[model samples]
Target chain A: MRRHERHEMTEEARQELAAVDAAISGEAANGEHAPLQELVRALRGVRPQPSGEFLAALDARAARGFRRAGQEHARDSSRGGTARAGVARGATQKPRRRALLALPALGLAVAVVLLAILLPGTGGPGPQPRATNAPSKAVFGAAQAGPAVAPDRAALQPAPAPTAGPSAPGEQARQVERTSTLDVGVAPGNVQATAQRVFTLVNAFSGYVRQSNVNSGPSGQGGATFDVRLPSSNLAAAIASLSHLGHVRSENDTTNDVTEQVSSLQRSVGDQRAQRASLLRQLSQANDPQRAAALKAELNAVEARISQREGQLRALRTRVDYTRLALAVTPEVTAGASTGDLTPSAAAHDAGKILSAALAVLVIAAAAVLPIAAVAIAGWSAVSLTRRRLREQALDAS
Target chain B: MTLVAPRQLATPQQRLERLYAESREDLYAYLASLLGDRTLAEDVTALAFERAFRRRRLFNPRRGSERAWLFGIARNAALDELRRRGRSAALAGDLAAEESSREDHLEGVLRRTMVQVALGVLSARERELIALKFHAELSNPEIARVLGVSESNAGTMLHRAITKLRKACDAQA
Candidate 1:
């Protein structure tokens, strides 16, 4: 019977435990497990409390930790503040540095532009204007003036004569003497043939070869040079024909007027003739032998003067009517010449030409690049300044 | 009952002081229950407050109440202590022994002792849930947030833990 009673109590405990579980699981209210609820309430009431000393110690430790943390925070903020100040200073100075760098570059650019605008007007071997109607100061020989009178006085003071007729329209035309030099490249072994062709062409144009030379190089490559004078009217045709002899590597042409010189020489000739006529009249009327001899001597002197002046006039007229041409014929070898053909002197000459050309290019390049380099430097400085300022601004804001 | 003020208007230090004053006792109690030692619980409580003070700048009141946050820290401190003591193994041994030594009769004080022993029989996770629910007195959703689980999951786990505790208690009885 006692065993049955114990069993009944065990059943009651299990029922209460089930009710507690149900309440804790939210399936039932705490009011449904009043006995178990009461037990939980009592257990909670017995929950331990910390001692006063423990609470005090805990608060002290916490305060110490807080103090340390505050110090760290202060250190961090101070470092950040220093960094911010540095950024601010940099930002302020950046533009000034950029301006400093850019000022000289801008100045250089402006100077270069000014130079480019002003340089072309300064210097070169340009053609000079011809002086028309000027007397020729060039005296050919002492024979051109009588011995009895000073050469300068005689030439300066001409016998009083009727004013000369108005110059013919053709004579008044500006006389321009044209001359040219050409370098022609011909096939190897064809230099002589090309030179002969040039001679034939000159004769056809009523031109004369003033000087001619032909040579064969060690490699059997031949070359020829010619100084020729062509009628001025046929100059263009002569050059065209010479170009066909082979390939003209280079050509230069120039013109000069000698009309005033020609006219002056003609006047000198006329003066000499008048003086000779005066001496002849004196010779025919003279009675004393010594006077006749003196008059004859004056007449002879006047005639010699006339001849010299005539020669000068003829030479001037020849120069005015014909154009001089200098031509060089070089054999064009398709294959390399033998080493013997490349003389040290020839190589040095070539090297000198190349060096001079390179120097000229360098000078021209320097002139062209100076302003561009200045502008580029300025642009680079501006870009870098902008980037630095932006970076500094970001740092300051942070 | 001290009310949680709007922390947005308060400075970090003021917010921390207020959080301490309001939740210190409850947090201490929860740590004591979770760790099962008053001295260790006090140490953990101080450590938790220090950590909270250091990280005060990171606190957002919109996330949760100060109590939930403090308890979460306390839970981690308690677990760290438990690990340092190597008590997890001992707890597991005690749980196994209790499982094998089931009894069905007890009442009053013996019942309370049985309940306490039964709490020891629970797994660390079950114990943590029980502590957060009963000792920390956090609501199911607050417990979920602290434990990083869903509210329903937290509730379900709590219910299972309570059932196990009741069974252990009943078996001890």
Candidate 2:
């Protein structure tokens, strides 16, 4: 209260309280409030004696020294809730306080943790994942039991020399188009040699390279990428053989079921062949020139369609029979690597970029969590106040 | 309201024991009056002491005296019981019963009956105020602290309650 408000008692209130002492004490208040004094005396006499049984039970409990039963939250948490009690209750509320503080803090911590988890995801393409000095083994480890999981194949990952398709015994023949990516890091001066070894491995697995790009840097420092297609049955083994040439930095596998497309193309090809055979038999027996010409033209059109459909079917079959692999070979970063990009300044630049990214993530996390934490704290405080008010209002109610 | 040693000098257990020794009767009387049930008042009174003992370290003598603090706890416990029962404070069957028929005169019995009936005329809040003022014998400032009200507001409420009690008594007469 302000200085004046604390001392701003009115004369009427002063007189109203003048006999309060004498009246409550049941003494005569000089004939001014004699009636009030009598009532006070009567009220004082209204006290009823507690039964001896209850007193004995109470004395027994008190003798036992009151063991804690943890029913204290209702009474202990809000002890001395006034401002003056803050310093006093702080000591008493210590153990119970961690519970109150942790609730809101836990909410904020979850938000920041969620933001941190999403920091590296989906924001205009942050820097590509770099291959650092440390070698990592990150196979998705959640897929297994060997059912040629297309979508979940990236989950536990294929073992070395894995047979990762419906080609397994007792499985239905599921025509699938499979594509995989593997990034291998080789020691300096071995990129070109590694690229050659990859081609050799593909050939051993009866696969062919459709495209190859190798950048040969000075001092045997370079990188290579190849789009190779291997026989479907040998895909997993071929990758396993090729990965032995270098350190596998990253790997991904994907599959698409093309069973319906293959089936449709097969039906189209069969229909075209049947029609062409009928036209050939009719052309051999035709006698009229004009009619023959018409028949021949129709036959040619059907023949062309047959060839086109056959070509389409062949391509579809080829795709289903072979899995495409994109392999990238990069020089492993090392202390003795002969790349100019491995200089201290470049390392510092990379570190700076990474630091900047981490800071951005932290700032974004803070910005996201601050408002929520504010609302939570405000809500918690308001709820506590309302609950206390309601508990007090219980007296006014039933 | 007893003058005691420095709070810091004594352990919380010692202080609470002293508070119990000094104030148990008044505490029970105040609760029995507010709750209007001998058994319930006894239960809540014991509950108040147990609660007080469990939270002994929380008592800050700087805020108010030990009696006021104990009364505050007792009041809250009684109020909670009252709220749970979802009824007004009905005078106990034994509360207004005449005690010691041999020593009790007819005039005293009638006076006690009239006072008890007049008490039934007040609201639960008014009854609690009267209990605090008369049975607990708390000063207005101490009562204000226990009730979470300003000193003047407590004084005004007490004055109004007392005035109503007098009017109720006259009507009963």
Candidate 3:
């Protein structure tokens, strides 16, 4: 029964039944209780009491934050007023700066733009336009503005037919239907054949050789010259024939001074005939001395005029019959001049030409690089100005 | 005419908010006793509510009531704040020193004085366990969840701690 009761008794009952309960309660008390009690009193003494000033400071900070936030929101909405306000606030908060630094940057950009605008022609001092050495200037010679000398027409007048010799089969002179001159630079190897072919072709096409001059050049540098005449009717065909001689380099065509000659001749002939009739009449009436003297003086003056006019008309007709074509031909191969390897003089000429071309290209490249260099220099100037502005602001703020 | 707004506009919506509004003074006093620093106690208490509110969705209605869930979160938050302050600050006995200098005779009654003295003698962990048990009034399972231990182990640990407290008081006498 006692064992059964022991099992039923709880731990709480055991604690209450223990004899030392009063001792346990007192002895179990904390040892540092007095120190804790003392500390509680100290805490109550030292704790800061909240005051109005602290609250006011907090309110001010809140207002500043709210104003800043509102301004930012307004700026996002594009009101623009907020943007100005922000700039003002930023300026006040930021350090002071000088306005002068930006001037150099702006000046540099303007200078670059002006330089670009003026660049192509007068941006920098370049070489002057070189004087040209065109071969045409020497070849054609300058035209003068005066009456030209005419051929002696008395000699050009139709003479008595020559006593018969065997008539060359193609000897009949053909009318000049058309005319043209060819320019050809005689190359080596075909100069003689080329010259002969040009002459023969002009004749075959109803043309005639008016003049030919062969210049076997001074000291083995051989060349030929040809002054050919072709019928006016076949002038175009003769020009086309000569085009195949080598290469027709350039050409020009002009009419001779025949118009003035024909007009002067017709007037003088009429005057001479009238004067002759008058002289005959005077001679018939020989009883009158005054009429005889007047007719004699008139006949002398008319005779002089007639002689001048006849000469002009004959020269004009001769020119109309003959058309001159000038040709220059050089030997295709000069055995002594180019027999071996390239001559030193020829190599030197080629090298000079190449060097000139390369220099021209380099000059163009340098001109191109100048603008890029200017732009880079301008960019550096701008960055330097901005940095200087920042430094000045810092200094001013300090 | 513009209408004037009311001054006291507080309206409790959640369990944590209700508990905070209803028991703030008691909770602050209990935490101040546990932590010893008023500011630190206030910070930990406020942080506990913030976390409890954030995790309110995780509370199981079938497992416990709102009061128990909030208490669990608060108890854990308070203990975590103490642990992070480190062992030296925990053992400084600043709270015990503050409790002794009270001018109010009613606050310094024998029973309150006895409890205060007993708390000062206890370790930080023991004080936390006692707070969770009696002041925050969390159950053993709730305390275990806050402390990250099993329910049976929490009970056993509490029993051992209480037995030690009783023996220490007896020896002090």
Calculate DockQ per candidate and list them: 0.05, 0.29, 0.01
Which CAPRI tier for candidate 2? acceptable
Candidate 2 per-residue C-alpha lDDT over A46-131 given as tens digits, one digit per residue, 9 for 90 to 100: 66666677567666667665544223323444542332132223224545866887887887888788877776632322223333
Q: By descending lDDT, how would the candidates be arranged? A: 2, 1, 3
- In angstroms and one decimal each, the interface RMSD of every candidate reads 19.6, 8.0, 20.2
**For candidate 3, lDDT tens digit of each residue in B38-127?**
555544444445545556568776765566566655554554444433323232256555544444666444434445555556766576
| Fraction of native contacts under 8 Å reproduced by each candidate | 0.10, 0.41, 0.00
In candidate 2 chain A, where is summed lDDT lowest over 10 consecutive residues?
Answer: A139-148
Candidates' C-alpha lDDT: 0.58, 0.67, 0.47
In order, what is each prediction's RMSD in angstroms? 30.5, 10.6, 31.9
Minimal lDDT window, size 10, model 1 chain A:
A134-143
Badly placed stretches (over 4 Å) of model 2 are: A1-11, A21-42, A49-57, A68-174, A180-208, A216-222, A232-257, A330-398, B1-4, B7-12, B57-69, B83-88, B91-93, B98-117, B139-153, B169-173
Per-residue lDDT over A240-274 for candidate 1, one digit per residue giving the tens place of the 0 to 100 score: 55665554567798867776887788888888888
CAPRI rating of model 3: incorrect
- Per-residue error for A264 in candidate 1, Å, reads 70
As a TM-score, model 2 comes out at 0.63
Q: What is model 2's C-alpha RMSD?
A: 10.6
Please give the distance, in angstroms, between residue B30's alpha carbon in candidate 2 and its true position after superposition.
1.3
